[model samples]
Target: MSEGTGAVTNAGEGEEVLQPFSVTIGATVPTGFEHTAAEEVKEKIGAEASISKDRGRIYFEITTDNLPKVHHLKSVDNLFVVVKCYDNYQFKDTKEDALLDLQEIAPVLPWSNALEVWKLNNSVKKKRSRRRGAAPKPKPSGDDSEGEKLQAETSMSEETEEQGEVCPEQDMSLQREQNSETIENKPLKFRVTCNRAGDKHSFTSNDAARDFGGAVQEFFQWKADMTKFDVEVLLNIHNNEVVIGIALTEESLHRRNITHFGPTTLRSTLAYGMLRLSKPQISDVIVDPMCGTGAIPLEGVIEWSHSFFLSGDNHDMAVSRTVNNINHIVKRRQTGGSTSPGLPIDTVQWDLCHLPMRTSSVDIITTDMPFGKRMGSKKKNWDLYPSCLREMARVCRPSTGRAVLLTQDKKCFQKALLRMSGLWRKTHTVWVNVGGLHAGVFVLLRTGAIFGSTPENKRESQKASETQVEDMMENI
Candidate 1:
């Protein structure tokens, strides 16, 4: 389908499939955030039709005509793409190495020249790599203390001669020039977020790295090392327009879709947690009770092959949105006449407080609990929060399945866990900034007591022992 073997420059009217193409992605923002992100990508290359929030990930289909123009923009060392390949409907990793790769898998394009814009930052960085430390202090010649004094006198005499030749006004002008030179010599560390809406190529910098870090502290929330950043500010620049994004990561990239919801899976935050478990299964069944908006459930459904995903949410609107989401995902998979349920998702409307399922049924439960102030209604948040967790313990299989839940209120969830007779065991904690709000993820395990112990008589014995332990801990 390509026009020819050689690389094509302009995406002219050619019936060719050989040319390369890319998809530009963006993340979450206020109401009007995507215009900047989209315009930035458009300025890089020509686009056909834009798909906003198709499946949690904002997508755009671009023509191959802008291949050369876009490819010229890449400067990063190891640019890769996160996609769900043809063989699978899950988000998988791919290398954006050559034009052929982009063309062969042309259905999914890079989020408006992501690699190219990322490379532009790399080039800028390379240009700014000026080393420091006063060159090497010239080794002192073998001279006694008196010799040093004589050298100082000679330098003073030279300065006096130079000063005498210039008028007072000229002296001031020369001093100003020297100061300007000094300022120029000081390091310039400009930090600008390149992926924000409508403000892509803008940057700001102080004369030094430390000062710049201080200046952008509020912008970046830089907790640790300043290095290891790809583009300090994410640059979604394509065709010359730019968007500014700060402290950009994979999660931020997924969230940048202005017209659509973010990806169901393969996002940085959720993916990191899933990978951490390192559990082995032949397409494990992951459930998300109280699956609002179907983010985690859809992600789980797409992450692996032969995986079974069951999602439930009490909200009717959420259920409708999720249904449309699932349909869109399936249609996208069937677009090129492909058939593979790499990760199939199943959805239902079920309240977490009283899940309509049996014990030891589900494998893993990962959900972002509805936070009162930010997401859920107050009275329902208070009532549903604890009850939902107790139901999680009731339905999960003992010792075989684990629960990873994220919430801003740890004390409430902790109390819920304690009251349930130690049904869930706390595993790990991860801190995340969701929409600029702080939250912690508590990974829990459904213990034997919650799902019913092994043998009939042994089950009662285990329950008594767990009760005793809980009582002692509560008393202490």
Candidate 2:
């Protein structure tokens, strides 16, 4: 045992050993992202350390060949051992010394390092044998080997046949069928996530627990609620699942894939940011008047299981692309029997500045306002904000429906809010890292009541009927 380095050592007790020590590595700030990064670090450390999440943090266990160095390293609180294992028959004094050394670093670790030292010794013995004797084992001969190979082939063929029959189109039907059943029977939680660095994917719910396996299982078990059980954890699998975590759907990560696409609002942020809204108990009707790439509204519908996934945008190309994408997703889900959820977006060719829907008809108005940096020109953005927001406010039921919007230009948006006569009130702001742009996601509530010239014009029109009042109003 070593005091400063938190290293566990094996003195010349005739054989080498491997040690298992649990560690917690500290994270650099812009907080709430340490958990995901820590898990990634654990994997990078190779077979020695494994991380399982617990209580919103990760539980890291490392197996080391050099116990003394690890013990010495323990003095650094950034990474310290919480548990240690050793063989019982040997190294009693060494274990005690190691414990004392590790305690000086982090006193909270449970379990003695001596009880399981035998296993480490065994592993060392096996490694030594493999190194010392380089000769490979001879292959099995004749019918015995042939029989085993044939059996393996048969099993593989059956699996391939089953998989070959399955396609993306049947995926949605399968999800709908599974929705009717309870969540307890599932094998692993399916999570979807966008591959954004520094985004928070640490929340644990009952759904996360049943769906995720490996390190995620440990984390979710400790932090999540278990009463409401539904297990599905979707993660962005790009970059070798480096950005792997929970997502609402696969579409949540689609925005990042658009190259030379420039700046854009992510669907994950828009969906998760809208939890503050007050709404009816209705099962569906989530609308995005400006559903560019079908990000916001798709997030809303998939996350909440809202039935009517209605979306509209002024740009024909964007609308067409969105339609094709959504249609592809829908068609795949219909034929593939997938358990994954679908947003089932219905795209319409319309302008956000003049919405086609009736007043007070929407349950949610979640959108990403186009800005000069992304798709629209600066002058166009200036013209678009107020008119579009006014229309969004007009169609939404005040006090009941809420709008979640993301914008890089907060000052201009605020001016629009004020000019529209309080159609929207700023509620909350989530600073998100969408690609490289650090932007604010705003949640606003519609005031519902008519504002600006609409109410004033009505009052003037009524005033014209009264003799004395009309004369005074007209003159003024």
Best by TM-score: 1
Return model 1's CA RMSD, one decimal.
Answer: 24.0
Q: How displaced is residue 432 in candidate 2, in Å?
A: 2.3
Best by lDDT: 1
Candidates in order have lDDT scores of 0.42, 0.41
User: Over all chains combined, what TM-score does candidate 2 have?
Assistant: 0.44
- Identify the runs in model 2 with alpha carbons over 4 angstroms from their true place: 1-281, 338-344, 451-476
Ten-residue stretch with the least lDDT total in model 2: 144-153
Lowest summed-lDDT stretch of 10 residues in model 1?
A: 160-169
- Over 13-53, each residue of candidate 2 has an lDDT whose tens digit, in order, gives 64333234433221111112233334344444432332322
| Candidate 1 whole-model C-alpha lDDT, 0 to 1 | 0.42
- How many steric overlaps does candidate 2 have? 48
